[model samples]
Target: MEVIIATFFYARVSTVEQSLDHQVSQANDAGFEIDEVIADHGVSGVQHILKDRPEGKRLFDKLRHGDHLVVRWVDRLGRNYEDVTDVIRHFIRSGVTIHTVINKMTFDGVTTDPVQQAVRDALIGFLAATAQAQTEANKIAQRAGIEAAKRNPKKYPGRKPSFDRLKTELVRNLINKGLGTSAVAKEVGLTRQAVLRIRDDPQGVEAALQRWDM
Candidate 1:
């Protein structure tokens, strides 16, 4: 008898109206043959662990050796950095491969190469840490915005942000790494002027990111 490997896409829907088919489509476009899509509606990924939600618990128990788990992002696996990391490690130990749509990142659960393992671990740690920081920063920004609104009820919404939260963070990270404006712009698919502005006024850029929740 042969073991049949299956690919599962997990989605955490924050609202009942949210359609996760696009996420499944995204995974398919990224070359994943999804065998199933496990979702938990109205469940906050930031508040619930994988095994805590009804469908989440099923997802955890359904995966097995040689299986693949696809997620829009690692943040879907749990509540924070530690939880996400733990969930990911547990899956790996169970021989379930993990893949994220963004950047087409993958963490092989059964790789034996030491260097590959090191890279996988480092990337997982960095991405999980980044997710945690982003969540905390979002809360702080929301609080500040509320306070500002209370003080000035007539303040208009600032100009719509061009770059998203992830893009802005990426720009900042590249700039911090000493990359030139042209290089950063090319790397992030932004215009030279935009990259130059980000390089010149990082603080204001960060403020825009928070203001627009981008």
Candidate 2:
């Protein structure tokens, strides 16, 4: 194992809307001894790669040889597969190690063997592609729900909840993405009970949103 000179944790979060609660703690819990915590607040990983984010740019410039970059997932590096692969490759070439906390995936730029290199590169490609696919699928689901909600908006007759259409959309989308009630609720800033209500009666919630012109 190569000696790590430093470890940095980076994440992109819409902190104004959501919370940035566990990113650094998660990395530490994953056994990465972080020397610094760098977060690109109000940035969407789905919309911008690490190079475009303010703090992300700093991260790229600050990393040095024998340094390790720890993230919750490989998706934090870029917005799409191409960008993700490119960024990972660039850092690896610069002798920086990239590791994901989820699977404990590590791409340390220390290997000379062709087989080890191939395996690591392939894993990076696969994870990046998977993250992109998930993002696309969530968008598709949200769009479909919106279109459906627009078709017949006359089912609701009660008071509207505190969540607006955007929050409702996020709730439904995350639920469709297979996130549990607590996760979806926490993500969209809704109560678990409210998320459960939306999950059990998506059409009702959509109709309520329409009623309020949300």
Candidate 3:
């Protein structure tokens, strides 16, 4: 009897329009024939763990022995060191292999040499730590920028709303219909925070849209 292995690609993006085409393109460039692609759109990696995410939960359930999991980077797997390493270790222990497209890094449980295994583990830890640190740094920078903007609102009006007229109308209608923020967000394919922004001050959002002539 013979066995066949499957390769799966996973990705997470913060915005709806940010497609996984780049990651898929990278895999193709690397000569990997992906059997499946699991993606979570409009999801924040900083807030959700693999199992907690919509499509991410499927990865744990679907991946099996001899399966290969491909990701663009360690950060895509998670936002912090603990979560990143935990997910990777879980997959490896389950007889699945992990490969990163960026650096061409590979992690598997098939190695027998103690020293080689130690080196691999160390590298994983280092990369995961670095990714976590980067996430924290980005958050800090964003906060600082917001504070600066507060000091001068004219100079920084903040980012424009993501929703257009149609989506905005849809969100407003959902809110008017007495739907909860979470339900409205799910229905409109938006984040809860985005829904809250509109719910908190529909007037303000409208004013901004009018001001910007959007």
lDDT of each: 0.84, 0.83, 0.88
Screening candidate 2 with a backbone cut-off below 3 angstroms (N, C-alpha, C), the clashing residue pairs are none
How would you encode candidate 2's per-residue C-alpha lDDT over 1-214 as one tens digit per residue?
7654888888877647645557777777878888888888888887787888889999878899888888888877765999999999999999898888998988877889999989989988898899899889989998887777667555333566878878877888998899989988888888998988887887888767778787
Q: Estimate, for each residue in 1-214, the C-alpha lDDT of model 3 and write its tens digit.
A: 6778899999997776666997799978987789999999888888999899999999999999999999988889998899998999899999999998887889999998999989988999999999989999999999998898767756665577777667788998988899998999999998998888887878888866765567
Q: RMSD in angstroms, candidate 3?
A: 9.8
Q: RMSD of each candidate?
A: 19.7, 15.0, 9.8
Which model, 2 or 3, shows the larger lDDT? 3
Question: What's the number of clashes in each of the models?
Answer: 1, 0, 0
Q: What TM-score against the true fold does each predicted structure earn?
A: 0.67, 0.68, 0.72
Any idea how many clashes model 2 has?
Answer: 0
Best by TM-score: 3
Model 1 residue 176 lDDT? 91
Candidate 2 yields a Cα-based lDDT of 0.83
Residues 73-143 of candidate 1 have per-residue lDDT tens digits of 88778659888888898899898888998887878767788898888888889899988888899899999
